[model samples]
Target: MLLELIEYHWAEDIDEVLLLLGRLDVKTVPLAGGTYLLGLHDDSIESVVDLRDLDLAYISEDARGIHIGAMTTLQQMVDSPLLKELFAGLLARAAKNSSSSRLIRNSATIGGTIATGSASQADLLTALAVLDAEVVVRSGSKTQVDLKGGSYEHPGLALAGVVYKGKHERRIPSGEVQLSRRPAELIIEVVIPRPTLAVGTALMRVSRTPADVSLLHAAALIEIDAHTYRKVHLALGGSNMEPVRLYGVEQMLEGQPVMNPLNSQKLLTILQEGMATFRPPADIRASSSYRRVSGMGLAYRALEEAMNVASWQNVMSSERGS
Candidate 1:
């Protein structure tokens, strides 16, 4: 595909950007970091709406939880004190490990990354999915999309955007759910709710080299009460279009006693059995068989680390009481 001339509009605010995108005559796309769009030589894009001036880059915390603006870069996430302290630094670790290149990390916006809907961003997506992050989008009105929950529906009205939500009764098989967004809609922010219970998280990835894209990755979030699992979230990447939540594995772990050596083997057996049905897409990076096996191992390790963090927190709580 050869590069074609395209009109560039530097928008002063969100309303301007939205207005430009909502135009019916010409095809327009939002530009944040431009990392995702620059690679695409799509001739259909008639105009580019520059969003850098919209004042979307911000990270803040409140009673609701953490709020990260759309234009916030990966490096900002990595350096955030709030992210480093929250959920055992799971988000920070994911952001740091997302790309070995400091330049890429500095330029890659979280919103743009999620917008791409690419499976290659497994590490970050897995972490977000496990954390039940909500994507706030603006079309005409704001809609919050929950990553864990299935698609959002608005009867009679075209959906402006859709995002992940946690804990749905009906599960999508293989946890393959895409963040659906219309061209006219814009993602404004991501919200991660504050955990009510003691929470621990872990992230694991397998790549050929330190900087190489992960062949597979897993992220786990475990909430514990009285040494029993109160809640569990397990997400895997590289097997599907989006990060897959291992609901089967999560269900098995929830309400179960914290993993002990005696029962660890049994749990591992269950985990392996649950993962057997996973069929990762074969690509130049690895075979389907290898990804499947690696997914299982990575999920298990991530779960183990989460449990360890939970246990340590319990011990610290006890010590404080004494």
Candidate 2:
């Protein structure tokens, strides 16, 4: 299936882009870097309005927070001093392995990343999901996403970017996991603030020789206190119709001990049980049971790593205090 090349229009201003959106058919998708939108050209779209001229594709810095322009490339993030020090957990780790070719990162945009949310699909969103971050979207009106959900709204041509509070002093801690058939295949970047008790997992099992899209994925944000787990947030991608929050896993791990062996086993068992609820229809790549098994390990690994981090932090704090 070959996608036919479509007409390209470079919009100098946002007003022009929005105007074009209002006039074109729903198939007319906006192009930031052509990383994802270009794939749709032959699928259902025919025209692409280039947004490079809008100046919406650069990284902005200020005391309030870091403003990553929707069009900024991954190369910029890879070299961004601000992102390197403050948001290191998310940006540094996520974009570090994007590819050796700077060209792709040079075209990847933060807005495009959030809107497409491929990281979650590709297993990168779990890191950002680990950090409890969202997108800042502007359509008819501007909106804020302090938490996950609504990233895929894809409100046509609009203003977008992943914004971070730049006021924090210390470097934030974040981690990510990718389920890929190859190194640079479709993937997501996960971000984290602190790695105490929270876990972020993005799992994609590609058993179909070379799997595309994904079979199942999960993202988590769990907080285990000094002696007990306090709060938990789990997000599902590719495993459900939309990115879903796993309440069943949350209900089981919110108050467990960080070092208790019995509680740990119970947590793992409960997570596997909750994940069983996900009924991924059989695709050419894998069966429902295979996906379930892989997903179970992915989730458990994320939780286990998050717990170890939490336990390590506790020891560090105690040593510093003493």
Best by TM-score: 1
TM-score of each: 0.85, 0.63
lDDT of 2 by residue, 238-301 (tens): 5222344567887777776665453557777788777768655544555767766676776676
| Model 1, residue pairs in steric clash | 145-163, 146-163, 146-164, 146-165, 147-164, 147-165, 148-165, 149-165
Where model 2 places Cα greater than 4 Å from the true spot, the runs are 1-7, 24-27, 41-46, 58-67, 78-103, 117-121, 140-218, 236-244, 260-264, 317-322
Candidate 1: 10-residue stretch with minimal lDDT: 166-175
Candidate 2, residue 313: CA error in Å?
2.7
Question: Across residues 204-246, which tens digit of lDDT does each residue of candidate 1 receive?
Answer: 8888887877878889998888888898998887534467777
TM-score of 2: 0.63
